[model samples]
Target chain A: MNKTEYLKSLSNELGHMPYGDVKDIIQSIEEHFDEGLGEGRSEEEIAASLGDPKELAAEFKDGVKFNQIMKKRKRLKDYAGPDGRGRIFVILFNAFVGIECWLLLLAAIIAAFCFLAADLAFIGLIVAGLITGTLTEFMVPFIFLILTLACVAVFLVALLILGIKYYAKGLKSYIRWNKNIWNYGLGED
Target chain B: MNSQIKKGILDLCVLALLEKGDSYGYDLAGSLARKVEVADGTVYPILRKLASEGVVSTYLQESQNGPPRKYYHLTDAGRRKLDSERDEWIKFCGEVNEILERGETGGKADE
Candidate 1:
C-alpha cells in the first residue's frame, strides 16, 4: 500500500492510538525497513516478509508506549554520552530514585513514631521511678530510646540506598527499553 | 528476513536514508522495500514518528498527477540523530559479528 494509506490502515487495525504514539510506532517500524533494505533486500520481498502491516502495528504498540518513546528519544544523547556504561547507570538511577523515595518516606514516618513512643516511655519510666523506686521503669524507657535511635539510623541509610538504587535501576530499565522489544511492549528487540 | 526484525529496523533505516536528502514518502518507502522486505503500509507510521519527533520535517508539494504529496526532509537534529544512531548500529553489529565469528569459527574464518 501507499504510505498514507498504509498508516491509516495500520491506525484502524491498532484501534487508533493517540496520534502522537501512532506516529512514533510508525517511525519505529520504518527504521526497521530501512535497515533490511540497506542490506540489499527487495521491496516486494521485504514487504511480504514483514507480514500484515496491521499485525505489525499491533506488535509495535505492545512494547513501546508514547512516553517511553519520548524518553528513548531524549535519552539518545545520553546513550551516546561519555561511555555507554554511564547511560545504563543513569537509567538505573532513575528507577532507584522512584523506589527510594517511596521507601524513605515510609522509613521516616516509622522513625518519627518510634521516636515519639520512646520519649513517652522514658517519661513514663521516670514517673514510675519517682512513684515506685524500681530500676525496671528506667530500663524500659532506655530500651525504647535505643530502638528509636536505631530507626533514625535506618532512615538515613535508606536515603542513601534510594539514591544509589535509582541510578542503577533507571539505567538498567532504559537500556533494556532501548534494546529489548518485549521490555517496552514493542515486540522482541 | 524475519518480520519481527524487519518491523524493528525499518524506522531507523528511513531516518538514516532521509539524512542524506529530502524525498517523498513513497519514494522513500519504495527505496527501503528494495533493501528490506516490508509492506507498503509499514513505512507510514515511521514517517509520522520521525516527523513528529522533529528529527524530520515534512511539507506538501504539488504532484504532477493529482493531489499534493508530502516530502520529508531531515532536520539538523535528525541528521545528528542519524549520525549518532549510525555509530551505535555499527558498534552493535560489529559486536554481533564478533559473537557469531567467535561462536562458529573461533576467529579463524569468516562466516
Candidate 2:
C-alpha cells in the first residue's frame, strides 16, 4: 500500500489533531525522510527504521496538551500573586520609575532656572546689602551651591538605579518564564 | 542484554524484518521471536503505530484454517524512516566507542 493512503487512514482513525499541529507532526516525519534520502537510503529501507507512527503521534499529542495546561497555570499565577504580591510590586515599581523620570526632568529644569535666578537674587541681595552696609550677605552664594549639588546628585542616582532595575527585571522574567515552562513539561504525563 | 533497551529496540527490529518483504502479523512475530524476546502483544501496538504513521498498511485475506488474517506491508515512508534510524544507531554507537576508549564509565555499555 502507498504511504499516502496509510497516512490518510491513520489520520482518519486518530480523528485528526489541530490542523497546525498535524502539519507540524507531518513536517517532522518528512524531515526524517529527507535526512534518510540525503544519506542515499531507499524509501523502503528508511520506512522500516521509524517503527510505529502511532507511538510517536501519542507522544506529540501528549506534549501539546501538556503545554496548554501550563499556559492556563501561568495565567492563574499572574492573578494569584506569588511571593506576597511580587507581581503587583513589580507593576508599581515600574510605574514609580516612569513617574520618577518625569519628576526628575522637571526638577532638573527648575533647579537650573532657580540656580540662575538665585545667582541673580544673590547679586541683587549683595548689592542691596552693600548699599545698606551689611556683612552677612555672603551666605546666599554658599546656600545656593549646596542646594543645586544635592538635587543634581539625587536625580543622577535615581536614573542610574532605574536603568539597572530595568535590565534586572528583563533577565528575571526570562529565567522564570523558562523555568515554569520546563517544570510544566516535566510534570506532565 | 538490558531489557529496557531491548524493549525499546523491539519495534525497530520488527521494522527491519519487514524491510525484506511484506508479511502478515503471525509470520512477522514468529520471525522476530527467533532472534529476540518479544511479548505476545507487543507487535500489535507497534503495528497500530506503524499503520497510524503511514509506515505500514494492512489488508485482510481469507485463510484456510479459521478466519481471515490481516497482512501488513511496509510503505515507502516506513522504509525511509528505518534506514535513517539505522544510520543514527551506527553513528551513536561509534561515538559511544570513542567515549569508552577515553575510559569513560569504564566502558560500560549503557545507553
Candidate 3:
C-alpha cells in the first residue's frame, strides 16, 4: 500500500472518532511518510513497516478512550476534595448517632466474652471435681459433661475470634465512611 | 513476546527514549523499531496516550528542508514515571529470573 491508500484505510477505520482527531492522526502519519520518502525510502517500504492500518486505528481508539477515562477520574478526584459543611454534618451525626451504634457493638462483644469466660469457668470446675475424685462415682456422666463443655468452648472460641475480626473490619470501614462524608459530602463513588 | 506485554513496555520505552532527547514521530518510531520488534506505526498511539496523560508534551518546530516537524518532549511527571517503572521492571525481572533459576536447579536435582 502507498501512503495515500494506507491513510485512506486508516481514516475509514477511524470513522467513529471525531473529525478533528481523525485529521490530526492522518497529518502525523502523513508527516512520517514524508520523512521516510525524504530519506529515499519507497512509499511501499514505509507503509509496510507501519503495520496494518486497521490495527493502528484500533490503537488510536484505545488511546482516545484511555485519555477520556483519565480525564473523568481527575474530575471525580477534584470533586471529592474536603467540604466544610459536609465535615460539620458528619461530625454532628457521628457524635450523636454513630457513637451509640459503636457503643452497642462494644457491649455485644463484651457480653460474648463474658459468656465465654463463664463457660470456661464451668469447665474448670468439672476438671477440678474429676481430679479430686469427687465425680469418680459418676464417671460416665462426668465424661459426657466434659466432652460437651469442651465442644462448646471450642465453638465459642471460634465464634469470638470471627466476631472480633468482623468487628474490627466494620469499625475500620465505618471510620472510612465518616472520612469520606467529611471530604466528599456523601457523593456517590 | 506477547503483544499485550509488548504494548505495556512500549510506553516505558517511549518515555525512556524521550528522556534522552526530544524526537519527532518518525525518528522516535525509527529508533524504537530498530531495537524492538514492533511496527513503526505503533509508537504514534503510545505517544498520543502519553501526551494525553500529561507525561509528554508536543510542539511544532520548523524543519530545514520542508514543513514543520512535531516534536515530543518528556515532562517532569514522565521522568518520575520512568524512574518508578524502571525500578518495578528490574525488581520483577529479578523475581522471575530467581524462579526460573530455581526451577532449572530443581529439574537437574530430580534427574
C-alpha TM-score for every candidate: 0.44, 0.35, 0.63
Clashes of 3: 0
Writing each residue's lDDT as its tens digit, candidate 3 over A44-161 gives: 9999999999999999999999887876586567794677888888889988999899899889889878988998898899889989998889889888988998898898889889
Off by over 4 Å in 1: A1-12, A16-53, A56-64, A67-189, B107-111
Which residue segments of model 2 deviate by more than 4 Å? A1-189, B101-111
Candidate 3 lDDT tens digits, B24-60? 9999999999999999999999999999888999999
* Stretches of model 3 off by over 4 angstroms after superposition: A80-189
* Worst 10-residue lDDT window, candidate 1 chain B: B37-46
User: What is model 2's DockQ versus the real complex?
Assistant: 0.02
Report the number of the highest-lDDT candidate.
3
- lDDT by residue (A1-189, candidate 2, tens digit) is 234543553355445466775664454345344444555776555455544456545545554565567667765566432343444444565577744754675576566556655655655665666567574556677456656655665665565566456545655665565444443432322
2 or 3: which has the higher lDDT? 3
Candidates 1 and 3 compared: the better one by DockQ is 3
Candidate 2 or 3, higher TM-score? 3
* Candidate 1 chain A lowest-lDDT run of ten: A180-189
TM-score of 1: 0.44
